[model samples]
Every structure is written in structure tokens, then in C-alpha cells.
Target: MSNLIPTGRTDIEWRNESTQKPPKAAVYPAEANADKILKAAYEHTATVWTGDFHNAKQVLAAMKKRVKRPSEKKRAGGGDAVAERSRNIQTAFHAHRMKQAQQSRILNMLAVEIGAGFTLDIPRAPDVKAALADVYGKPNDAPFLLPLNQLLGFIGAHEWHKKGVEIPALGGRIHVPFGVFSPLRGEYLDLIAAALAGSKFQTAFDIGTGSGIIAALLAKHGVPKITATDTNPRAVACACANFCRLDLDNIVIEKTDLFPAGCADLIVCNPPWLPAKPSSAVEAALYDPESRMLEGFLNGAAAHLNDGGEVWLVMSDLAEHLHLREQDFLPQCFQTASLEIAEVLQTRPKHAKAADENDPLAFARGREVTSLYRLKKAV
Candidate 1:
């Protein structure tokens, strides 16, 4: 953790729940240049303290620019390093992930201390009490330290929650809370909307229902009763709120791992598509860590489903393109789970990243297809 001290306070004190002793503090001067700050951050892992909030942001930007800037040798290579790595898609993907992890570690070294009531003592810092409360709930008397990047994320999340994302399929907005996954990509939702159109499904289960988008959509399409479950408390709260906002009274949100207690006519899950470990809570929406969630959903779907019920697994084929999973993996999982694919509905991504040729993974993103895999118990 970064040792962020308030200005004009010389005495240093650290508080924590851990039994281990705190490390010796490394504090940078307020007027330190970005190059000096970057050197300390990258080498000694020093915590930065700035009385001027704007200067801190500028230093962070400069640090990022310097860290990401390619070396002179790479510049002389005629083509960028990413282009060279693109020859092997898997290598490129892993390298990209490594770079991202490295960047996060270095950037997170820039820290700030938030006092009780979520007040920032730094000059030029905007009032973030509301945003802090939204993300961290009620504040305690003790002050806390957080990365400047994460503080920015909380502010952005509050703005997103204030102005919800519009879902064309539901003709309503779904406000996503901090730490909850927002439904920014509409292609997967479109598959659900199309699948549920004019459907007579009575009861449904939305597994891993982040923000309750799937379950809400199910209710909007006339499903009488729906049970949505998520292991994340934040997601459970966010989903419940969204359900109320959409005026969908039939959906019940629960803080369970995946499936709720009884059988249902339909079960839907959009698990994290990547088969990699997530670095943060929010990244859980993208990385599944060895496909645990996916395998769990497939293995348990049959037991919690009624006769003739269908399990709609929404996923993208980007994993295969990146060599993260084999083409036959899903089929084999379904077979092992004694489930058969009734229908596979596919939709190509319409997101900007899919169309951006400059993206390192453009080859994979271009061919990526989001699919609604309609599966059922095999006799």
C-alpha cells in the first residue's frame, strides 16, 4: 500500500487489521517531477503525496506515457512490437495481458488518503463524498488509502450510475453500480431479446446475474417469475435496484453463488468469456479463471431445470480465436454434463473495438461471434 500523508503532517502512523508490521514508508516530495516520481515508483515502489491534486494527475499521465513509450530499438524495428507479436495470436494476447498487469502495478503506486466522511484534503480536489459513499457505503471514522486510479474509477462509476445505460431491447435504462459489470456490449443482450420474443416461459433462473440485466429482460418479455443469483453483494444490490427501476416486480434477486434453490423453466448465464484469472472485482466480468463459472453452470444446469427447460448460455467465440480454449471444449463439456445443444444462435459483435483495425487483437475480435447456446438435458 502507498503511504499517503496529508500535507504539513510529519508524524507517520499506519493502521491495519493484519498482524504483520507495516513496511518502512517511502514518500516523494510534493514538487517532484514525473521522471523522478516514475523512477521511485518503478524501482523503490514509493508512495506519492501531492498537495496539488492536478499535479498528481499530470504526473500520473506522464508516468504512463513514459512507461508505455516503445524503446528506440523497437522503434527502429520498422514495425511495432505488437505487430511482430501478432504473428502468434496467443503470444500477443499473453503479452498484452502482461503489459496491462505491469502498467496497473506501476500506476497504482500513486495513492491518496481519504479522511473520514470521504473528504480529500488536497487542494484542487473535487468533492468526492457522494461518489465514495456510493462505492464504499457508509464511511467509518478512520481514514483509508486508495490508488488515485481507483479513485477516478469510483467517480466514473458514480457518473454511470447517475446516467444509466439505455437498453434498446427493454426500452429502459439499467444503472450499474460500482464493482458491478455494466451491460455496455449490446450484442449479447440482443441475442436474449430475440430469443425471448413472444416466449411463454413461466419461471426463469438468471445465474451470475450481474446488474440483473438478463433477469429483468426475461421479466419484460413476460416471464411470470424469475430468480436471479450472484455471489457478489454489490451485484445483488445493483440488480435489485435495476429491477425496481424497470418496474419489474416478478424478479427476485438473491446473493447466492449461481443457481437459486428450485427448478425453473429457463436458466440463463453469461459467464466471463476469457479463461484467465481476474486481477480485480470488476474484471470478473471478463475473466473466468480456468472457466470455473462456465463449467459450474454447465454441470449444474440440468439439476435445477424443469422438464423441457432450456439453459441459455451466452458467450463469445473470442476465446477460441485467441487460443485460450479449444473449439471442441464447449461441446465436450456439454456432453460430459449430459446436456445437448438444442440450438446455437449467433450474432457478430457491433462494438467499435471489433471494427478497429489498429487493435492488436483485431484479427480475433473481427471473427468473434456472440452466441446464445440453447441447451437441454439429454435423455
Candidate 2:
């Protein structure tokens, strides 16, 4: 039980969810020192294997308490320097990301094994077969190592997927699958609904439609025809499942990046807000990595618009506040795309993070404004 069997062929080819190179793991019992585990993880990028479910949780927690964040006062030279650095949004943003990345690296070092048939052999371990199937499909013939933290995330996502997210605008819930972007924040959905209210389009396109919430919203708004597209096969499946649940037969779900073929009178896109690389598959919905998706949508939207049509670009200004993107960037993109901004609908974020003083990015979140840019071909 100490050894993790590979999912395929030889036991040497151990698999992890991230698909990154497997870390060298050493079995650590419940009595293992958390400080020593942290030191090993940091120094050698080693993984800790434990069979005690509760002990793994406790040890991971202990390891977290031992992990040190860079001392802001020491790094900033103390006193007014620390306060000045805190006020500098860009500096604080990068520091926050770095700290988060480091913490994740150390914490993910704690791992657990799943046996064949998706079994958790540890005492007091909850059955995760169903949740594992939800994301990874049927179990492989062999066992694999999974980060305990990521397993917890999978369990939580399973619960959320079971319960589904309540979207008041759709008058129902949207079941977000594991690794798909959940619509925890409803402000953006409200903006979409408000934009479509009392309006009719012959045809519509929902770009990068994760979980098909926006496409469902469009269908609910009485759009006669709609095309929803996503680059992720999981998202495409998620969207298709959601469309079926909503009985939205008119909308077509396609596995394509950004936009589908043909033109539409109305095209709605809620691109990733930040201009940064995503560390994980889920973060793809949050970070755009050099604004590639945003630029693609803007650059390609014009060619996919019918006469007298409008393209609605939904985004947030949080990146601007963080200095990740310049304030004039979108305007410049619009100019280059030869699209005229007809109207800009804006709303302040009401999420808890927006008001949480303890949040590292609170400065940017507090000033964040989500907007729906209604654009048209320049006359």
C-alpha cells in the first residue's frame, strides 16, 4: 500500500491530475514532522504520501502554518516603506501571486493514493468514486497518486455540481462540472440579462460559453437561434449538458475556440478578465494570458456580425487597477478592430472579495467595474 501503482503499463509511470512531471514521493506516517515535510517539499520538491485521511488533512494544515510568506515589512524596509508597497497595486499584485504560487507548491506536496476501481483504502476516507468519475471518467486498471488538496477540490466541486448554482436570471440552476468555471458571482449574469431585456436578435452567438449560462440566458430571452462555442471539450460537454437541462433545443454547442462559423445579429462574450497566464485548467476562465482571448474576440467579432448587429464584450477593469493592463488597451483594441463602442453598461462587483479588507487584491477588487461593451462596425 505504500507504493502508488501507475495508471498504465509499468508502476514507474505514476500519473497526477496536473499532468506535470510526477514528484519523487516519500511515505510519511501520521507521526511525521510537519516542519520536516515542508523543508523536504521546499528543498527537493518531494511529495508526502500518507494513508491516514484525517492525518493527511491535519498534516497539510500544519505544513501550511509552517510555510512562511515573505515578510512585507522586511522586504519593503519597514515603516512607511511597507505601507507604500501595500498601496502600490501592481507590486502588491505580483507579490500576492508569488506567495500564492509558493504556498500551493508546498501544500500540494501532500498526496494520497487511490486504488483500482476508484477506491480510497484509508480509514475514514470518504468514497470518491463518483466524484472521480465526474472529472476523470471511469477508473483506470491501476492506482495513481492524487494531491490531497486537489482531491478535496474535486469533492467540493462534486457537491457544487450536485447542488448546482442558482441563477435567478435563468429562473433555475446551472450545473457547473468539475474544472468548469462556476457562476458564483451573479452580477455578470445580471448584466447579460439586462443587455438582452426587451431586445430581439434574429440569431446570437455566445463566445467561450462555459457551462452555457449566458447561452441559456440568451435562449431564455427568446432568442430564436443561438450558437455557443468553447475550446475546452469539458466546457463544451458542460454547456451541452446545461442546454439539455434547460430544454434549450435551439442553441448549438460547438467545441471550438472563441467563435463559431457564420454571423449573428447579437454576439455576447465574457472573456477572462486578467491578462496573465493561468496556473491551472480552471484558472483559464480567470486569466487571459496576454489578453489573447479578448483580442481574438475583438479582432474576429466584426467579421461574424450581421448588418445592424452588435457585439457585447463583457469584462472587468480589475486588471487595469492591478496595472496588468493599461486603461486605454480596450479602446485601442476597439479602434484596431474598427469597431465603434455604441454603449458601455457598467456595474460594480458585489462579491465578498470586493469588500474584504483582508484580501490581498482588495485594492483592485474594490475599484473593479464589470462592463458590457456594446460595439458595432465603424460607420
Task: Estimate the TM-score for candidate 1.
Answer: 0.90
Among the numbered candidates, top TM-score falls to 2
lDDT of 1 by residue, 157-221 (tens): 99999999999987899999788899999988989999898778899999999988999889888
Q: Please, what is the whole-model Cα lDDT of each candidate in the order they appear?
A: 0.81, 0.81
Candidate 2 CA-lDDT value:
0.81
lDDT of 1: 0.81
Q: What lDDT is reached at residue 234 by model 1?
A: 89
Angstrom error of the Cα, residue 236, model 2: value is 0.7
Per-residue lDDT tens digits for candidate 2, residues 214-278, read: 99999999999999999988899899988988898999988888778899999999999998877
Which residue ranges in model 2 land beyond 4 Å of their true spot?
A: 1-21, 28-30, 45-48, 68-83
